[model samples]
Target chain A: MKPRGWKELNPGAVITEAGSARKFKTGSWRSFKPVWIEENCIQCMMCWIYCPDMAITAKDGKRGEFNYYFCKGCGICALECPGKKGKKAIVMEEEGQ
Target chain B: MSASRVVAVTGNESVAEALRQVNPDVSAAYPITPATDIMQRFTHYVSNGKVKTEMILVESEHSAMSACIGASAAGGRVMTATSSQGLALMWEELFIASGYRLPIVMSLVNRALSAPINIHCDHSDGMGARDCGWIQLWSENAQEAYDNTIQAFRIAENMDIRLPAMVCMDGFIISHSIERMEYLDDDAVRNYVGDFKQLYPLLDIAHPVSYGPLILSDYYMEYKRAHAEVMSKVKHVVLDAASEFERISGRKYGLFEDYRLDDAEIGLVVLNSAAGTSKDVVDAFRDRGIKAGLLKPRLFRPFPYEEVGEALKHLKAVCVLDRADASGASYGPLFMEIASSVSPYSPRPVLLNKIYGLGGRDYLPGHAESVLSELAEVAATGKVRTFKEYIGVRE
Candidate 1:
């Protein structure tokens, strides 16, 4: 209903150039976040390689973990992964997109 | 990288092959000359079922981008291509693509933006879209054309990087040139690009999510704030994709690249196919003991501000060459962005704006010599100018 902008609460946007912080445009969470299904992931490591932000993570020794720290929540992996649908292991959820 | 082995696909065909590589679900287009060939290739793919995607032929470029936003919102990988007046027509939907953060990837043929009207190549068409919040990339050749299209999808589709991108290549030259290009095999491209699953598909009847909701002033600034935040994702996306594209294509590149500039004191900023010409000129300059080098722009829209500024930081004279004129401004749009990038820094190098190749005017060897001569003058004068003479123009 309203536009997204900078806030004291969120990390907000980065100051690309010099000068004081400009007015906030929108709060991020407007984008989307991706959720991963642990059981279905075969840990092919494709998500990490193809991830533009390198947002995917691996578990300690066990492997197959995604920190989702910087994940915009694009479901490319979940949708393309063999485990999708009845066995969708990685699903996209709405967050600070 | 060896230029001899380069493939000779037209700019439009590059878009068609790029569509196959990017692998979108819904493709639409309203063709213009030079750019029409792009939709042609896409049509063949759709008919042959090689791409396995919907090829929607729209009535106009405006509807093409709007339909793209809808398709992207509905969670389909989408693509389109246009040039000159067609791009001018799509201006409104261009902003809509960014506002909705649809991450739509379109191809611009880098034709001269019309007034007196020319079908030839220039930055006017692409520069007009500068403030639209889409990532812009210019290709030196058809390979970069193919390469940027795939990386554009990777950049636009990333959540933090969910903005649109216009992968620009010269309309007639690179678009029409027939060279030997190593086309990426479908499976390998599929493996490299993976699939574009939408962040949250708007069409899912069960899970209703918001997209381009009405934004009052309060919230409007915030989404724009996030838009700024999302561009940071570009540094990562470009680097990551460039690395892989290089591995496959074997010609490594960055957002902005320096040719013969490693130790040169003179900097010439340029974009598109002109970079190839500039490289030869730089060699001739070096033979004459003039250290003039080139700062070729790879990514125009995101502006690649930091890389460009840093590259020119050590130069004695930084000549900003613009292919498109910005009417009343200091010079062309690219020159302005360069000047502003180094605006705050003191003892800044000199910036000279040289407008060349309007209405498809050619920048030949004699023109290159004159450009270098002017650089010699600026290096000797130390005066910072917002404008300079047009190179190789007829009286």
Candidate 2:
């Protein structure tokens, strides 16, 4: 969609379209990234329930993937992930490392 | 024309009756002096099942205005009422209400702002909120208060001018005093102020919309400009609503009322209940062959600048009376607006500012006569001894 001019703006400064916030790429703001390890994963979906940005994606009632398009990499999902023994299901790493 | 019923009611009751007739979807208000009677009477209607409005008795004026904003944003017709301190408490939400373009109607019983705490009639409360972005309507008497309250919903809800509106009447002078006022039938009022239709309702999940977005420097100016554009269009909306109201009730209304202004050399500009007293003095002056006239402004927000300029251009001199003090400014708020409006004329009329009735001082007809006499001297000698004077003050 084309950007609106001052005259074309809404009366209440409203964004009329649903889910328009998806157009803004916020992942670029992250210096660290969350990487998921499927091997040490339990399908508890704790991270899915706790992600503030709705960045965690679930598939077929099981934990699936992270939508990096919006994830700011605050690491809440990794911190809340319940994994086996000493192995973590998710971990935050420096971007481009 | 529909037959009207006349009832003796106070200004507060008139507003409450209008609210009952409109029967908005929601109302959230707190009790405050001068304005308390309005919400109190409306609460009775709610308890008696007279209307289907959902009444929310909020904890504070801030919460009252906040609840109204929430209801209005969700596409519900909403209203509230407040006075001096109550209005001051709702200051923050007042901006949010207008910024979101919610068409919430409010009845503001004008009273003096407090340091010593006095509850009486004055313009201080309403005048203090001039820049809050809501359209303001000043009522002279009980009838005008009732009519303005009904007209306010239509004006605020107009698609081109979707902004919150306030119907203001002098606190004790009009709000407590009983007067004979004719009221339109309930069906007429309901039909005139039709259903509430919103362009972007928060409750419409099928077609969702986001309101009050956080806009940075990239788009904040554009959003403000849009709000300003809508405010500029309010004047025409108010006029259209007034004309439609006139058709049903047989009462004519305009942006400002010019009483005997034609062929007058001296003019007095005032507002609210004081205009009633000034009109009587104008008649007395006319009997003695003095060309005195009164200009009472009904719409104060989108002030009829061009019309006011044209009205005062022919007069030799004009005195602008203000019930609120601007404190430290050369002229009061009303006087400054009047001066700016008439400054473009080739031969501008000599203008004087008379700050009076502050903190609910009694403004009698004799006080108006004294100001007119001063204006007559200015008109004759073509010299203003002082640009501003305090009327009725001992020292």
Candidate 3:
């Protein structure tokens, strides 16, 4: 839909709906993406707690999946992952690879 | 036909009395000199349980306005007050409050901006915020201050003009000086102001809304245009409110007051308390058959251009007395507005600017007399010795 002009806006130009930010795919901003492996995942939830975009989600009694729709691929989750013996549970991969 | 009583009160107390009667849902306040009396008196009403207003005692003027904005956005009737520096501190949030279209009413006890730290009456504070999108009302005395404060709510919350408003009274002079004023009964005030109808309250989760969003090149201008459109509609709302208020209080009001301007050859345009002094001088000039008149603007914003232009167009000469300095401009702020308002006319009046009473200096009747005399000379000669003059300044 074509956006309305400034003169068409009501006062304050308030965004009316809740959680409308989800409709915007910020993943397009990512040049590299994080690939997760389940074997080395300890489910410490550090990635879940520290993810700025709340991209990492957790389920009961297990590690969760990354909702990349909102993530910008900052690699914070991969960098904070504590896999044993220097093995990273999450690693960055080039987009479209 | 609301029952009313006459009371002796200072301008600050008068504003407080009006606020108490309106009894807004929320009031956020930080005290400053001259303006401090307003919040102080209002606080007493809060403590005594005379009103149900949630009084938020903020640490600074910025927080005072910020809290008022939040409360207002939350669908509560909100208000606050401040003076020179306090108004300056709230400068940023002033735009935010108005841009959000929150109907917040503020009492700005006009004071001079500090360089040497003066706390006296001047137009510097109010004039500085003239473009901040708030409807501005200047009061000539305690009675007008009380009346304007009550009218501000109706003007600000009018459906077509939901912008914040500021009712300004001269600091120290009007704010502290005691004067006789007639006040409407509480029920009358409440009924006149009516209930505050909030547009998009944040607490309305059923229909959630996001305020103060980041709109870039796609729609920033549109939001500003919408704000401007609402402001342009303020004049009619102000007049309607005044007319209704007159019905209840029996005191008439207008965009500006014309005192003996009809068939006058010379006129003086001024604002606030100085207008009172100018009126006395105008009467004196009239007795001498000088045909001098005075035009005092009650509403400064949504400036009554056509009204002002037409009023002055017939005059041979007009002098604008501005209490605030426009610093380096050929004329002061009021003069600039008058100049532009009448600019389209083909044989405009020989307008002159006089900067007077800066930093609370005395604006005596003699000083006004001097300006009127000068105006008469300019009218007779059809030429001005100077475009602008600093009145009462030591040579």
Candidate 4:
């Protein structure tokens, strides 16, 4: 993005509008991505409660997929996921793979 | 103008009187030598209900400045006081306060930094923070110190130039020595400084604003550029405030004060209390038929370069004295500034630098006489001697 010139910047770099933090995308910082396997899932909503970035998408009390735009790939969701036996619902994978 | 009382008090007492009259909303301070008296006296007013200021006695100078930043962001008139090491300790917060555009005022009692473990008057402390984006007003004595303290409020709080300012006075010399000064009535000072109008105050909850936000590389330079642009407007604001202050108290001020410099062939540039001593020597040289004058810079940061250049360009020889040494740079800070300002003019004056009075050594009148004599000789012969030399140091 072409940066704004000095004249356009606000005095003291103050952000006048609230919640401007949403404009920045932090997901690109991740080296690993969280992969959700719905086949082994038991919709416990634990990932939603454990996700630090609020990147877990949900609707009407049901667990959904990850919002990659904001997720940092912390693997917290995969760690918190309670799935059947040795098969976890959420797993971490290298971003490129 | 209202009636003001004449009082004999030390610089710290006079500054405390000014703070008492203006009665800022918050003052967060930590005690240090030479400047401890200013804050200590102010706290008495806070205790006796002489002024309604919230005094936060912090653990260190760093925390004092931190509390000042928080209080100022919350939209209150804030002030503080410190000396040498204390000022050094608050170094990071100095940039933060100015960068955030907080109109905080500080009374900087100039003292030497530690290492020799000294507590004495010198310009090292204030000179060290010269580039921190705060407006610096140098005062010659108790009277000027008190006047500058009162004027800093109006200048810093100016909406067009919302930057922090420091009113600097020599430690022990002006800070501790008793001098006679005038005090404007409390009502006059109140009416003069008026009220602080906060810009994007954090306390204005209905209209939310975030300060010191995380600005990445893409926008950080632009923000700094904008900050530099604001400083370009401070010179005008300082003058306007001085004029307003003149109305309340009949003392006039300017970016720099010229003493007998009109058509002067020999000149000297000095700062703070040394200027007071240099003026008498200038008169002595005048009596001896050597055309001598002096220029004492009142506004050091965002220096009045063009005006200074114009003032010194006519002289055949000019000497710049620095109370603090810019070690390894060879030339003193003031000399470098004067050299740069006058670089463009044809027939530029012969500029010399003399490092003097470090660690509170006495600035004697004889020292000024010798420097002026050198200027006289260089002007007459049109030849140069050593360009930079340290004065008052034992060989």
Candidate 5:
């Protein structure tokens, strides 16, 4: 969005709209992305429960891919995956790789 | 004029009287010297049921100001009082209150800052917070203090100028001294300030508005610029409020009080109680054909620069006496502002700065007379021996 001038800004910078945080894309803040390995996935829903930003999308008793629009990848999903050794359900990778 | 009762009261008591008339919805304050009596008296009103204000006794000035911000955001008329260290402690929250455009009125009993640890009157406290974005109304005596405190509510709460305001009175000088002043009728004050209305009240669940949101570089400057623009409108709002107040109280007010400055060769600019002292001295100088005058600034914060400049432009020379020093700075806070006000005019008055009366030092008529004598010399010779000096200091 284009920057607004003083005349165009709201009084006292008050944001009149509720839940406006959804408009801001914070995914760019992440340097690492968590990649899900579907073959090793137990669908235990650990990542969905642990995602601080609510970035891990989930369905009825099932999990979906990371919602990068809101994800600020902290690698907590890969750390808490509980998948054994090299066959981990989630792993971290550099972005744009 | 509306019915008013004449009574002798201290500055703190007068301000408390105004508060009783205002009967703010909430008050949260932690006391400091010279200012404690104001809140103490206010709490008495609360206990005796003279006012229906909710008193929130806080642990510190910071918490007090924070609570005031909360209450003000919740669409309540809020007030508090403090001095010196108490004001310094509330520094960060002061900005937040004004940034949110809360019309919280505060009684700032001007006192000296600590370190040397003096408990006395000084401009250091109010001058320190001069740029905190709140409107400042300085008083010369107990009467002015009372009047200003009453007017502050109307000025700050005006829809076009919903900014917090601080009514400043000298610490021990005026706060403790008893003087005769009139108290406007309770109903008269109520009608004057009128009912409080808030635009996006936090208490209103029907329409929610986010306050104090984090606006990044994309819009931070615009928000600040808007804030600045609003301050530019304060001077007009203050005059409007003052005129309305005059109809009810029969007392005139202006951005700054001009005492015989109309046709003067030399003048003096001072603030708070010192202005009262200098007024008498100006009268004495005038009697002797010195053509002296004085300008006492009442609405100091969006300082009426153009008005001040126009008022003093005709004088040959002018001296700005400050009650506190700016320490490492070249001149006192008031002096810098007065200098800036007259900077645009051609063939301007010869300006001088005087730092005096720190830690409640006596601002005697002799001190004022000496400063006027110096100004007289400068006006005569069109030269200044010293641009700035400390007056009433021991050699």
Candidate 6:
């Protein structure tokens, strides 16, 4: 007399395999990580403010840092940095796991 | 595509900057308001080697789409951008690209369609191309616009769903407005979006496959029917890409985002920039003792019907707002859609249509407040229109 759950859900109704276009991911899995530069940090918060997902956060400015958990390793912060700070400051490199 | 930093720039620059970072193999685009400069920026990226992609400034949006089709067919990661009439012109081929199942991504700078010929923000342009078999995503602002373009590649390239996508942002408004957009790095975006792999290509001589083949009486309907079903299947892939993008970009780019809808008894549905305006209005009404909320549809195609329909059962009334007009119809494109989807349900909300801001008329916070007020007024009276109400039209 128990209610039906996902265990009893019909597999016929669920889409198991879609079209061939999206069967699997085609790109490399190991992407970049953005590391903030404290010296060039003006506290303008462009890195945090500009972050689409708020991956860059508001720290006490105890040296620069960015939240990489939600960070897609988008180098926008590094590219948009006003200074000539390259990978050395906001480095977007593959995390060695 | 390589460099990384925050700098001042407009929406056009934001798009160009984002695409440069994505670095498509071939960017075939025509000059159109707001979106023109993005293509121009790509030219500079090509020249400077910042983006190692080929730039082809085409004569027309039609040719631009065709060129993109060609590149995508050739197993190349291709991109193009357009607005308003340009999108309308690409209507026929739009279906072709999708039917062929090419995962080419394009940026549709949303604009009002013509008769009087106005070039400004509205869902008019993108709405018309809604069912073109492409994955349609409407962005709220320049940051969403920049991020959506990059996200489109991921959604399209996804092997489970081989279809093109239109990463739309309202023309001029988001396309021209200056904003601080977080640009994703090539490596990160590459990981998020992956690359274009043509599962069915016409160019591979060793493993040849026909694209855009003429379907006859025996299999035409079957092919078309399968196409729609394929799109439905791709829905999961879209969500997969969404989760991955959010993981990397730290943004919530989902099919729908609810604004205080959990305990609400009424719902307001909107798309594009209007959702932002509506959210503010919804907040004001909530302050004044109204149980109202907003539902913004991010993806148009593969219409998230079941998800939305089930969500609407709790509401007493619903307001469906569309930036485009489907003349002589009971409601605008969106209004009719929501109504039909909720038909079989017994306790469906009183759906009404508010067709506003055509030809890029200003959509202020007050308009949204007024809309909420009207819906409130209707529920109080137990009466709602089956026709469209043209808001902001002085005449």
Going through the candidates in order, state the TM-score of chain A alone for each one.
0.52, 0.88, 0.82, 0.87, 0.84, 0.53
CAPRI category for model 1: incorrect
List, residue by residue over B1-395, the lDDT tens digit for candidate 2: 67789999999999999999999999999999999999999999999999899999989999999999999999899999999999999999999999999999999999999987989978888988888999999999999999999999999999888999999999989999999999999999999999999878899998889988888898888888887778788889989999999999999999899999989999999999999999999999999999999999999997878988998899999999999888787889999889998999979889998889987899998998988998889999998788888888997
B1-395 in candidate 5: lDDT tens per residue?
Answer: 79999999999999999999999999999989999999999999999999999999999999999999999988899999999999999999999999999999999999999979988999999999999999999999888998999899999998987999999999988999999989999999999989988766889878888889887888778878888899999999999989999999999999999999999999999999998889999999999998999999999998999999999988999999998899999899999989999999988999999999999889899999999998999998888899998988898
lDDT by residue (B110-181, candidate 3, tens digit) is 999988799999999999999998999999999999999999999999988798999999998899999998
Cα displacement (angstroms), candidate 2, residue A70, comes to 1.3
lDDT of 6 at B189: 71
Candidate 6 lDDT tens digits, B1-395: 33345656777788787788788888788888757777887788899998777777778888899989888887889888888988988888898788777888888888888878888877777878887788888777778778778878888887766789888887776777777657766688766666567675556667654455434464566666667667787668777777877777677766777788888877789887788889988988999999999888777787888877777767888889888888776579988778877887987788878888787788888888877887887778877654467888888
lDDT for each candidate structure: 0.75, 0.92, 0.91, 0.92, 0.92, 0.75
Superior candidate under TM-score, 5 versus 6 = 5
**Model 5 chain B worst lDDT run, 10 consecutive residues:** B198-207
Q: Model 1, B1-395: lDDT tens per residue?
A: 21223355665676688787666899878989778888888888789887778888889989998899889888898888899999999999898887677778888888887677789888788888888888988888887788788778877777666778889988787888865666766666676677787766777756655555455675567767767766666777888878877776676878888888878778788888877788888898899898888888887767777777777777777777788888887577888888988776777777788888876788776666667677777788865454576766768
- For candidate 2, the TM-score of chain A alone relative to the native chain A: 0.88
Q: Compose the digit string of candidate 4's lDDT tens values, residues B1-395.
A: 88999999999999999999889999999999999999999999999999989999999999999999999999999999999999999999999999999999999999999879789988989999999999999999999999999999999999998999999999999999998889999999999999877888889999899888888887888888888889999899989999988888999999999999997999999999999999999998899888899999999987889989988898999999999989889698888889999999999899999999999999999999999999889998988889999899999
Off by over 4 Å in 5: A42-44, A83-88
DockQ-better candidate, 2 vs 3: 2
Between candidates 2 and 4, the TM-score winner? 4
Per-chain TM-score, chain A, candidate 1:
0.52
Model 5 lDDT at residue B65: 99
Query: For all candidates listed, what's the TM-score of chain B alone?
Result: 0.94, 0.98, 0.99, 0.99, 0.99, 0.94
The true-versus-predicted C-alpha distance at residue B30 of model 5, in Å, is 0.7
lDDT of 4 at B85: 96
Report the TM-score of the second chain of model 1 against its true counterpart: 0.94
Regions of candidate 6 where Cα sits further than 4 Å from its true position: A1-97, B1-8, B385-387
Off by over 4 Å in 4: A39-46, A82-87
A best-first ranking of the candidates according to their TM-score comes to: 4, 5, 3, 2, 1, 6
Root-mean-square deviation of Cα positions for candidate 4 versus the true structure, in angstroms: 1.5
